[model samples]
Target chain A: MTERDFLCLTPFLIIAIAPVMIMVVVSVLRNYKVVYGFSVLSLLAAFGSIFFVLPSIPHTIEPLLILDVYSMFFLGIIIISALLVTFLSYDYIKQLEGVREEYFIIIFTSTLGASLLAVANHFVIFFLGIETLSISLYILIAFQRSKSNSIEAGIKYLILASVSSAFLLFGMALIYTAIGSMQFGDIVAALTGHDPLSLLVRSGFGMMMVGVGFKLALVPFHMWTPDVYQGAPAPVSAFIATVSKGAVMAILIRFFFIIKGFNNHYLFIVVSGISILSMFLGNILALRQKNIKRLLGYSSIANMGYLIIILLTGSNKGIQASIFYLIAYFFTTIGAFGVIALLSTNEYEAEKIEDFKGLFWKRPFIALVFTLSLLSLAGIPVTAGFIAKFYVILEGMKAGLIVLIISMIINSVIGLYYYLRIITMLFSTPSEIKLPKLSITGNITIAIVGISILVLGIYPGWLIDLIIRFVSL
Target chain B: MNVFFYIAAVVAIISTIMAISGRNAIHSLLYLILSLLAISVIFYLLSAPFIAALEVIIYAGAIMVLFIFVTMMLNIGLERETEKKWLKPCMWIVPSLLAAVLLVNLILALKNVKSIQPDEEAILPKQVGISLFSTYLLGVEIAAILLMAGVIGAYHLGSQKKKVKHRFLEIN
Candidate 1:
């Protein structure tokens, strides 16, 4: 590889090295604060390294990776989200006894995996990235092994994820057999020659969609979402909900756009059906959920349902809308889960709706931040979620996806009801329970997320312009 | 070559079936090993001797031995009587039938494709290694990372703690 190739790979290389460095530090020093500081510094350095490669916009490292503006954009989101999760995890994980430092090491590895997904240009890298991310998550979810719930979620995710990975590998094998290539560019070149997809390719793509759907928590493949979210620590749940799903979403967009999967009638119909089902079922199920984390899980399914509508739009505007939507979602989700993480102590998880009873009376600041997050999720005005949803709906209409647009709108309203219910509970008569003392790191993370949401909601022009300038299929 | 291929394929299929359906874990594992060997024979017959050797040495030899050890260490077969009572024909029949249906469909699909005869020349191990290290080097690195994560996670989760109380209470 040339120096330029190495330059394009700086972010991934940095992230990859961080975990090993942390492992070394752990073996020697075994200080939680030191490891945590090193992790944050490494992430910051990785984020900064993106600019060093900015002058070299589009660079493909053979069959494996492509470092481009689009991937960089996603890398930015993934790295920053991972950093925020690390911040939120500080107090949450510190409260756990023993082996706390390894948490940062796992976060570094998972972030590396997520970053790899953003730059992946081959099936091999795609599969490896996903496995790295999922395996780390399995450990992270079950990190609090004393809790049977955590262990249950980890095992559940492991089995389901492995099954989905099998389907994906089989699909990849089938597709390779059919097209005689695994590279995205080569597959599309081969596909353009065949006007219609063959049975084998169709089946392969169908099975591949199952794996993607499972990652995105789309309908029918969404059974694990609520359980896993509820079972995992709040910060880890935030990591899974945002960074993991966003990385997959980034790869899916790239893959679909390259393959032109949206143009095929059957593929389009199938995706539309999945999205619609996800929106309705996700919202409907969330309506009765007392567990706030599970409620957010279902809401996320609905949010993803909304997000995929842009995929069917089959336009550059659609891609921008999707990225914008993900940014909004990253902030909203982390903010919401950060609140849970803040309220939760080592002794108890503050996940149930009743746990937040009269939270506004007790701690008005946290309640307000939670309110902002929930409102944004519900697509209420003056929150990032509203503008994100509106952008998506507008793009969907531009592509004349009326059916999907209608479903999203209806689902948003249904989503509003549950969000409002929680908001109401937050404001109701005070419950007699002492809240955990807020840490400086957690509070700073929440403030950054809250401000970004408002900024994106109110003044999204700059980010949109940045996306338009750099991001291209 | 064709006859040998067919014989190995049939053995692989039969052993795979036995592996899944066998009541005892050790028996099932032994059947699985047999199936893997049959597959390796087919691979060798198809002229990919390197992959066939790797399959036997890595999968059948190393991984299967680990499985056996783990199963033996768990002493899972001590409850064979209880498992046999629970493993009614009804429990196995539906899945077996479904799998058979899938197998039939797969066979039909394969029948539609023209089969290409394997070349007489075998793929050398040196060339395989060259390509794997050169073209797929990034994949190999990623896989290493994946394995490291898996090992660390497994080690972390598998290690037993002295305090086996409520996870909540165990936390500070």
Candidate 2:
């Protein structure tokens, strides 16, 4: 509320206003091109503002938000992904009928929510950030409501997500009752002076874990992932896979580390168990999936398991690994889904495995891009997934989490079979379905993502050293 | 005031049971409205007149009426005349038990606290407005955005490609 506070909060304010500007602009004279252009530009401006204001950052917006190197990193990832998603949506929304301009409104709004998660410092801000994301996603996930499955996914996501939010509120109530504080720093202060593993605190965190787990699509709470992913528009699914999960990952690190939640014996055991179960369940379930989107959904669950292993280390190295893996995963997922969005026709998205049959013969460039993404996902050699997974495994080993490392390795091998299966399907005799022409925007997103994956895979040391430099500083 | 509050509370409990247990959709909606009205009376007895009015206006009047309109438009369960059975005593056991347990816990919890007196001054609407806009300004802003998003969502979902149904265009 100070002038300095307002100055430091400019990045978030820019993102927040961009959507409203789009709303007013579109209401007066609707143009999809202008809206899309503005949405992407605003996100870029917000991204740039973060760097311009970096010297002033480590800014505390007291009791609600904190902007620091950590938050700035996640904010950078969020904006980049949002920019790419906006580009992908340029073509994806055009494939749909009616009210294309509103798509940018939802996209920018979701981006704002994601960025808030990156900087949230209090439970109230956390819940608001999450609800903002979830509520917008309910509409975006069901964006293609003409499709029955989209509506089904929307309602399912709405009901289940609300239930999870209720659990989260109840957990926050319990924690608030126990500690008499809602800020992360206060909760930690309270717990550090007492027995942190008290029944009240653990139960509160257990419920909160269910809420966060639901968002991340970890085991038992993960049934919605495949259905929601398959049913949503490809660009929206890409947004969910990257930006939403990225935000929550940042939250997980912030919340858990602040409370030292992992130090509790029962809590560690519970997280480790979920991590292992997700690794096995995600991979095994995905083995039989014929839908490319749903397959990616399951693999993302498994990938989350791998990410959790690194976090178990609870070391700076572990955090770095998680961030690196998340970046790699974001690029690969958006690139892969971007290809699908381009191939999506007016009537149907290129969802079915049959839809992708002999894609190599039809469009060799897309097929090659898809191949690299899948290989990266499979953690094959010379792909970003391999390097990312390698860092996580090394981090886990450093923490003596050998069992999880073994399971992850086994899962990745099991992963290779299906990824290869899809690769073969891509190269099989060309089917009659003609591929759609990609818009310039779509082509650029895919190209940037594909090249990033390759460059990051080949030379991860540059980004890692960069992350380490910032993270250490 | 205490006696009137107890009476309203009992009425609310019974009407709520009827609201969910009633076979007819219209009957359920009416019962829900009654329950809400009873709760509003209890709130007024507790000296929160603004909240009491809101309980009636928003919950009983607006939301319940919306539910009634939806039920009438759909006219669901009308064709299933054979299933229009009255609420049986057996159907009341689970919810009644749950409500009883909740009431017991509530009473025990409130045992440590001072009870509200009917003579207490009600919170002024102006105070509520000032605090909302001043202290919780961020909440107000976020709420405005939520409302806008809700409007955008409703417009996107509800507006049809074909505006009105015509006799010639009607499906068999």
Q: Write the per-residue lDDT of candidate 2 for residues A1-473, one digit (tens) a residue.
A: 78877887788789889889998898799987888888888988999998887888888876777888888999999999988888888877886877878877887777777888888888877888888888888889988868898999988999999998898888998899888888888998888856546788888999999999999999988989999999999999999999999998888888877777667778789889999999999999999999999999999999888888765787777888888999999999998888888899778789888899999998888888899999999998788988999888888888898888999999999999889999999999988987787777777778888888899899899999988888621
DockQ (Cα-based) for each candidate: 0.62, 0.35
* Model 2 docking category: acceptable
lDDT of 1 at A210: 95
TM-score of chain B of 2: 0.64
TM-score of 2: 0.88
* Candidate 2 wrong stretches, greater than 4 Å: B1-61, B76-135, B163-172
Candidate 2, residues B1-172: lDDT per residue as tens digits? 5555676688789889988888867667767777787777677666677887898899988998888778666755663652344245554454455445435534543462245452467676787789677655665666566666667777787777864678688876
Share of the reference A-B contacts seen in candidate 1? 0.71
Off by over 4 Å in 1: B1-7, B76-121, B162-172
Highest lDDT among the candidates is held by which one?
1
- Write one digit per residue (lDDT tens) for candidate 1, span A1-473: 78988888888889998898888878898998899899999999999999998998798999889888999999999999999999999999999976888788888888878889999999989999999999999999999988999999999999999999999898998999999989988899989967678999999999999999999999999999999999999999999999999999999999999888888988999999999999999999999999999999999999999999988988899999999999999999999999999999999999999999999999898889999999999999899999999999999999999999998888888888999999999999998988888988888899999999899999989998998887988
Highest-DockQ candidate: 1
Which residue pairs show backbone clashes in model 1?
none
